[model samples]
Target: MIVGGQLVDEPSATSPGTFVSVDNGVPLSATNPAGSGDWTGWSITRSLIDGLPALFARNAATGALY
Candidate 1:
């Protein structure tokens, strides 16, 4: 799916990828959440946000990321 003009692919469950849900609407994420590997917080991406897996749920009424 396309968010914030960026491209994201829900290729698989084990490798569902990553995404950031901004309260005000900004998107940044990974293509593989499970294999995101080691990190040191040097990345300038959004933190404390829910990342959707290949199999995810969304609220239809508000289009909220759940």
Candidate 2:
């Protein structure tokens, strides 16, 4: 996930989820629960498959893109 413009590792139940400070929208420390917490820090800024340019052709019988 993303936090304050940087990527962060997944969070656990005990460890607070990725979150940002509402005051300035900065990534708050996992230890700090006073700030916005348990927030999903994901953004679709670009296409992940853009680098892998390819065309998948499915079999005539199969309707799946392969």
| Sequence-dependent TM-score of model 1 | 0.18
Which pairs of residues clash in candidate 2, taking residues 3 or more apart in a chain or in different chains?
A: none
| Model 1 alpha-carbon drift over 4 Å, by segment | 1-53
Model 2 alpha-carbon drift over 4 Å, by segment: 14-66
TM agreement with the true structure for every prediction: 0.18, 0.21
Instruction: Give all candidates' CA lDDT scores.
Output: 0.35, 0.37
TM-score winner: 2
Model 1, span 1-66: residue lDDT tens: 444333243233343464333333433353323233221222223334366423443333344342
Count of steric clashes across candidates, in order? 3, 0
Candidate 1 weakest ten by summed lDDT:
37-46
Candidate 1 lDDT: 0.35
